[model samples]
Target: MRITKVKYKDALIQALLFIYLIFTVYPVFLMVITALKTNAEIIKHPLSMPIKLNFSGFIKIFTTQNFALYFRNSFFVTVLSILITVFVSILLSYALARYKMKYVNPLSIYFLAGMMIPIRLGVLYINELLNTLNLIDSLIGLILVYTAMTIPFSMFIFMGFIKMVPVELDESAYIDGCSERKILFRIIAPLIKPAVATVTIYNFVPIWNDVYFPLIFIHSPEKKTLLLAVTIFFGQFQTDWSLVFSALTVATIPVLTIYLVGSKYFIRGLTSGALKG
Candidate 1:
């Protein structure tokens, strides 16, 4: 009776889980289905399987649009932004975690403030500042904004993770005559690596998906990023739903790939499991 009850409960839970998964995933599944079908088939059979596969929407998108440029630009900005955010955040977090100082907490609170404040609220000022630096509508302009926007949260995550690590590791390194930098890289950083993966996955996806900053800061045809590429698909086809679906499905590949690769570390970091024995 006990085993039978357990089996029944497990079956019910699995059924619910499958329903939720389908509910979440079906829209994208439908969109991909649409992208692969002709407009006639989509209109006639909405959810039915495609009669024949179509790559025309995708072909038109690449050939008629500056999609390649957008992919390159977004790739460059996101990659550079992630590298900078991680480097600055980890070292700064180490200092706050390992060294006691009068202002460390206050400085951390400052980052918290920045995190809470929306970057778009400062749009006017940021645009003006970038103008003075001649960086407006440039990839550099996008990178600057992305870095500033993500720093606070990244710092916060790193701080919590570094705290979770034992200070004994730092002390042991110091006893061996290792310098501060050496202690950070060789001992502390290696210990707290999981949290870094967590922060990266969280920040990287948003940075890649952001439409507002790129819309505001990147204007030149040569410099438009991927989200902006999705916009072009909207215009040239006069809102062709088929092409829009194709472009969107294609654009989602990178973000999904990144999440799949980083998700394991992200889970570890969120659970703070890396700090355990």
Candidate 2:
């Protein structure tokens, strides 16, 4: 009787999860299908399947709308910023994890404090500082902003994983005549693959999707990120749903690709960090 009840409960949970998955995925399915329809078809049969796949909207966006430039800008900023954030966070986290120092705990608290306060609260000051440094309206400025914004969270993740690594590995490497850099890069980093992947995947999506920072810092039409360029599809009188869907579909590709690539490690990292931390 108890076994039957447990089986029934498991089945109910699975059914609910399947329903939830449909709710989450149906909109994305609709958007992809809608992007394949012409404007006339979309107007006539908003929810109907496309009679024929259309590539014109995608073509026009790249050919006429400077979308390629926006894509390039977003890719450059997101990738570079993530690279810098991960590199710096790894070094800092490794030190904090392994070293015994008087101020280490206080220093960790100081860095973690950034996560408690929303970075947007200091936009005025950030803007003023960027202006003072002559980095406004520049991709470099955006990269720096994104790097700073992501580092705290990245370090948090890295430190969790770094702490889980046994200290004996460092001692073994040192006895084998390995330098600190060699021990860190060769010994420690390999053990933290999941954490590295988790940090990269976590930061990648937000940085790619962010419009708030780009809108405030970038005024040049040519320098706008992909999400910023998407505003062109909106207007007061009538919205071009076809163009909007096409642009959205294009924007979704990179994020999906990154997630899929990192998903294996990402799941493991989350589980490991949760269980071990």
Candidate 3:
């Protein structure tokens, strides 16, 4: 009787999960199908399958829109911001984890406090600062903002992974005449690969999808990132739902690909960071 109840409960949970999965995936399926249909077909059969495959929408976005420039800008900003955030966070986290300092705990808290403060709250001051430095409407400005925004959370993750490292390893490296830099990069970094992956994946999505900062900071059409460009693209092509859908599909593909490829590392890093911390 107990075994039967357990089996029934498991089956019910699985059924619910399957239903939730379908609910989550249905919109993406719809977007893809709509992208392949014509505007007329979309109007006539909004929920139906595409009568024929259409690559025109995708091709038109690239040929007619500044999509290539938008894509390039987003890629440049995202990659550079991730690199800087990870590098600085690793250094800060390593210090907090390995060294004994009077203000270390307080300093860690100082960085973590950034996570609680909304970035929007500082927009006025940030704008003034950027204006003073003449970085407004620039990719460098975007990269700086993203790096600062991501550093707190990335540092948090790296700190956890660093804390989980054995002190003996550091001591052994020190004994072997390994300089602090060598110990950090050669020994500590290799062990924290999962945390690095987690931080990269976690930071990549928000940075890529961010429209708020780009809208505020970037004005040049050629300088627009994919998300900003897509918003403007949709505004211009709103009547053609097929074209809008195609643009959205194109914008989503890179993020989806990154997640799919690094999902294992993401999960592993998250679990390890949480448990070890």
Top candidate, metric TM-score? 3
Best by lDDT: 3
Off by over 4 Å in 1: 1-6, 266-277
Q: List model 1 lDDT by residue over 1-277, tens digit each.
A: 9999999999999999999999999997998888888877877898997788998888877888667778888899999998999999898888888778998989887877886578899999999999999999899888989998888878878898889888887788789999989988887788777777788887888899998987887878888889886876567665476788888888898988987888886565445523322
Off by over 4 Å in 2: 1-15, 236-238, 264-277
- Each model's C-alpha lDDT? 0.83, 0.87, 0.90
Clash pairs for candidate 3: none
Give each model a TM-score: 0.89, 0.89, 0.93
lDDT of 2 by residue, 1-277 (tens): 9999999999999999999999999999998888888889999999899999998878888997889999999999999999999999999999999999998999898988876677988899999999999999999999999999988888888998899999998998899999999999999999998788888888888899998888899998999999888765555114567777888899999988987888876566456534543
Q: Indicate whether candidate 1 or candidate 3 has the larger TM-score.
A: 3
lDDT for residue 35 in candidate 1, whole number 0-100: 88
Candidate 3, residues 1-277: lDDT per residue as tens digits? 9999999999999999999999999999999999999999999999999988988899988998778888999999999999999999999999988889998999988998887788978998888889999999999999999999989888888898899999999999999999999999999999988888899997888899999988888998889999999988788888988889999999999999988999886676556545643
Clashing pairs in 2: none
